[model samples]
Target: MDYEFGMLAWSMAGHDKDKLYVIIKTEGEYVYLSDGRLKPVERPKKKKWKHIQVRKTIPEELCSLTEETIKNEEIRKVIRRFSNV
Candidate 1:
């Protein structure tokens, strides 16, 4: 899977399994994820790509985020919107 910034994914192997997160950064086979609550944008969880299941839904708000922009609240809102569905 080709990981890009702002992509929504779910942790599949760790204690956070089934929890939603947004891809903040990607390095090789590892991707940094943030839930915007437990794991804020300032401190992302680095997990292997194989451990995350990419979601088809990509929030529109994600497109506005950049490496310099930190929008933890938006990330949290997007996750809440999808997880409820």
Candidate 2:
């Protein structure tokens, strides 16, 4: 059940914490929040055709790093806590 997903990170609107997104591969080349499909840049003269890339969301529950959720903390904590060996 291993699949690749994109890491789309941004600040949540009106919220202090960073927001991460995860979307199914089948959804393909789309931002979870944006209505338009995520397309790669191409020259104006060339026809647009390429592999679709997508932004995947990471669950919110796993977002906290420190013993308590500290404001404006470095992401190093989160990385150390959850990163693969």
lDDT of 1 by residue, 1-85 (tens): 7888888998999788898899999999999999999899899999999999997556788787785695888898888998998
Q: Which clashing pairs does model 1 show? A: none
C-alpha local distance difference test of each model: 0.87, 0.27
Off by over 4 Å in 2: 1-55, 59-74
| lDDT measured at residue 23 in model 1 versus the true structure, 0 to 100 | 93
| Candidate 1 clash figure, as a count | 0
Error of 2 at 26 (Å): 22
User: Which portions of model 1 miss their true places by more than 4 Å?
Assistant: none
Model 1 vs. true fold: TM? 0.92
- How many residue pairs clash (N, CA or C atoms closer than 3 angstroms) in each of the candidate models, in the order given? 0, 4
